[model samples]
Target: MTPETSAKLAETVDNCRRHAGDWELGITLMLRTHVTIDLTGGLPSVDADLAELHEIADRVGDRWTRAQVASAAGEVALSRGRYDWARAEYEECLRLAREVGAHTEVPFAIARIAESAFCSGDFDGAEQLLAEVAREVEPYGGVYDVRAYGGMLAALLALVRGDLERARAECELARAASEMIAAPPQLTAGLDNIDAVLTARAHGPEVGLAKLGPTLAAAVAAHCAERVLASLCDTAAVLLAAAGRSAEAVRVLAAATAWRAGHPRSVPEQAAVGGLPDGTRAVLGPDRYEQEAAAGAELSPAEVVTLLTGS
Candidate 1:
C-alpha cells in the first residue's frame, strides 16, 4: 500500500475503534481485513490485524463479525501452510457466516476447504468438496471469487491426473475469472505459476521458467507468503532441471530454501527439503546437488534475483 492509502486505512481503523462494540463498524473492519489479506497475501502486518480482530470477535455479539474473524483467520492459516487447520477455520467460518445470513463467504469457505483437500493429495475428497461447493454456490448467483480460486484448483487436479486438455480449459476459466475481478498479481500469479507447470510438462522447462521465474520474483516482491513463492519456485526448479539446466535449478532451489528459512512455513508437497523433487535428486546426484544448493543458500535475494533473471 502507498503511504497515503496506509494512512487512510489506519485512520479508518481508529475510527472503528472509537465505535467499539458497534456491529456495523466491526463488521466493516472485518470485511476490510479479509480483503486486505486476499490482496496482499497475508503479510506480517496483518498478524496484528487478525489478533485484534479475534479479540473484537469475542467482544462483539454480532455473528457477522464473528464469521468474518473466522474467515480471516482461515486466510492466516493458509498463509502459514497449515492446510488442515485452515480447513477447520473455513468450516467454522461457513457455519458462522450462515448463522448471520446466506453470506457469500459460505461458498468461499467450502471452496477453500476443497482446495486444502486438493493440496493434501486427496483428489477424491477434493472432488466431493468441490461438488458440494458448486451445488451451494450455483443457486446464489455464483460469486466470481469462488470460481476464480476454484477454477485454479480444478486445473491443478487435471494436471496431477495428466489430463492436459482439461487443465487447459480450467486454467482458461480461472484466468477469465481473474480478469473479471481485476484481482491483484498476488492472486493471479497462483494460476500463472500452475499454468507454467503445465506448459513446462507439455513443452519444456525453459518455456516454463521463462514465465515462472519472473512471476515468482514478482510474487516475492509483493511480499506474498513464503509458502506461495516456495511452491512456485519448487515447480520452477523442476522445470529448469527438465530443460537440462540442472546447475541453475539447484541454485534456484537452494536460494528458495534459504529464503523460506526466514518464513519457516512449508506445505506438504512430496519434497524432502525445500520442495525439490526426488527425481531432481536422482539426476543431479546428491553430492553435487547439495553443493550447488549450499552455494545458493548463501546468495542474497538480489543475487538470487540476478540468477533468476539471468542478468
Candidate 2:
C-alpha cells in the first residue's frame, strides 16, 4: 500500500482500539505505517508502537507476537543505522520465531541480520547470514525478501570486493526477484542506483549519469525512501565529481544532505560524504565549496529536482 493510505488506515485503526486484540492490530498497523520511509514524521514514533507491542506480548505471553515485535524493532534500528542493535534484535526474532513455529519469518529475519552485517561493513558476516537465509528458503522455492534484499546486499558486497561479474549476476537476481514481487518504486530505484554505480565503474561517468538522471528524478517525484534517495544523490555526486562537474557534485551532495537533515532516520551523513572525489574539494576550494553547499541546502525539493534533472 502507499504510505499515505497506510497512514490513514493506521489512524483509523488507532481510534477503534477497544480491546487487547485491537491494541495489537492498531500498534502493528501504526508501526508498519510509520516505519515506512516516506510517511514517518506524521505519525507517532516507532518506539511508541514497539513499546505497546512489547506490552501486548507480555500480557498475552505470545512468543509469535514477541518475535514479530523483535523483527519490527530490528527493522527500525537498521533504518537508523544501529547495526549491532538491529542484529541483536533480528537474532532474538529468529530464535523466537523458531520456537513459535513462525517458519515464514525465519528466513526474513536471517536476511535482515545479513542486512545489518552488510550495512556495518562486515561483508564476511553478511555472506554467512545470507547463505543461511538461502538454505532456509531453498526448500520453499526461495522467499522474496531473501532473494531481493539479500541479492542486493550480496551484489553490493561483490562490488566492494571488485568482483564485477559476480556483482552483475547478483544484481540481475535482485532485479528478477523484485519484478516477481512487483516491488515498490523505491525498491526498484534502489536497484537502479546500484546499476548506475556499477555502470559508472565499468563504463564512464557520463554513461552512468545518463542512466541515473531519469531514475533519480522519478524517485524524487515518487517520494521514495530516504535511504534510496540519499544513495541516488551520492551516486550522482560521485559520477559528477568523476566527470569533473565539481560544482554540480557539490550542489547535489549539499541538497541531499539538507533533505536528509529534515528526515532524521536516513542513512548517515558520512556515507554521502565519502562518495565525492577529493578533486571536487580541490577544484572548488574549501571556502567556495562550503558557500555553494550552503546555497544548495536552501533549494526547495522542486528546485533540487530541476537541478538534478537539468530541466
Candidate 3:
C-alpha cells in the first residue's frame, strides 16, 4: 500500500480506537491492526499500543490475547536485533499459547523463536524448532509468517552447510510460499536476502549484488524492519568486497555494525554470512579499512541509503 493510504488507515484506526474506549475486544482488535500498520511501515513506536493492549488483556483475563501481545512484543525486539530478549518473549508467548490451548498460535510462536535462534547463529537449534513448527503447521497448510520464515531459515541453514542444492530448493519453497500468502514486505525482504546470497554463490559477487541491489532499495523504500535493513547492508558489504569494491564494502559493513551496536545486545545474521570477510580486510590493510569503517560508523541510516543508492 502507498504511504498515503497507510497514513489514512492509521488515522482511521486511531479514531475507531478512541470511540471504542475501554471495550476490551474492540480495543484489542484495533490495537492489533494498529501494530500491523505501524510495523508494515517499519515504524518503531508501537510500544504504547502494545502496553495498552497488554493492560486490556490483563484486565479481561484473556490468555490468548496475552499470548498475542507477547508475540508482538517479541517481534519488535527481534526487528531491532535483540535476539536474546526476543527469544525470551517468544518463549513466554509459547507458554501462554499452550496454556490457552491456542493451537494455531503455537506454530507461529515457535517459528518466531526459531528465527531468533537462526539470527543468533544457533542453526541446529533453529533447525530443530523449525522442524517442530513444520510438523505442527504443514498438515494444516501453515500460517503465513510461519511458512515464510521457516522456509527462509531452512534455506539459510542449507547455505551454511554448503548444501547448495538443498539451499536452492528451500529458497524456492520460501519464495513460493511468500508469494502465495502475499507476505508483508518485511517477510519478503528476508526471502530476498536468501536469494541474493544464493545468486552470489552460484554465479559471482557482482551478479549477487545485481540481485541484492534492487531488493535493498525496495526494502529501504518500504521501511522494512531495522534488522532487514541491516541484513541487506551486511550482504551488500560482503558482495561489494567480493566484487572488488573494498572501500564501499567496508563502509557499508561499518554502518551495519554501528546499527547493531546501538542496540547493545543486538546480533547480526550468522557470522559466516553477515560478518565482513577477513580476506577483504587483508586486501585493504588495517589503515585503509579502519578509515573507511570509521567513516561508515558515523553515517545515518538515510546517509547509508544514499551511499548505497546514490540518490
Give each prediction's root-mean-square deviation over alpha carbons: 3.2, 3.0, 3.3
Candidate order by TM-score, decreasing, is 2, 1, 3
- Clash pairs, model 1 backbone: none
The candidate scoring highest on lDDT is 3
Model 3 TM-score, 2 decimals: 0.84
* lDDT (Cα, tens digit) per residue for candidate 2, span 214-293: 88778767766556666677778878888888988888787776666543432323554574635677899999888878
Of models 2 and 3, which has the larger TM-score? 2
Tens-digit lDDT track for model 1 on 1-311?
Answer: 44576678778777876865556566656756755665333456677777777777787757777777887887777766677888888888888878878667777888888877776667888888877877777877758878888888888777778789998898998788888786766667788888887787777778877888688778767656556666676776677777777877888777666655554433334432344546566777999888887887787555655676776
Worst 10 residues of 3 by lDDT: 34-43
Candidate 2 residue 33 Cα shift, in angstroms, is 3.8
Once fitted onto the true fold, the runs of candidate 1 whose alpha carbons sit more than 4 angstroms away are 19-43, 262-268, 271-288, 298-305
**Poorest 10 consecutive residues by lDDT, candidate 1:** 265-274
Error of 2 at 103 (Å): 2.0
After superposing candidate 2, which stretches have Cα over 4 Å from the reference? Answer: 1-7, 19-27, 38-44, 262-278
| Model 2 TM | 0.88
Against the unseen true structure, what C-alpha lDDT does each candidate score? 0.72, 0.74, 0.75
Order candidates by lDDT, high to low. 3, 2, 1
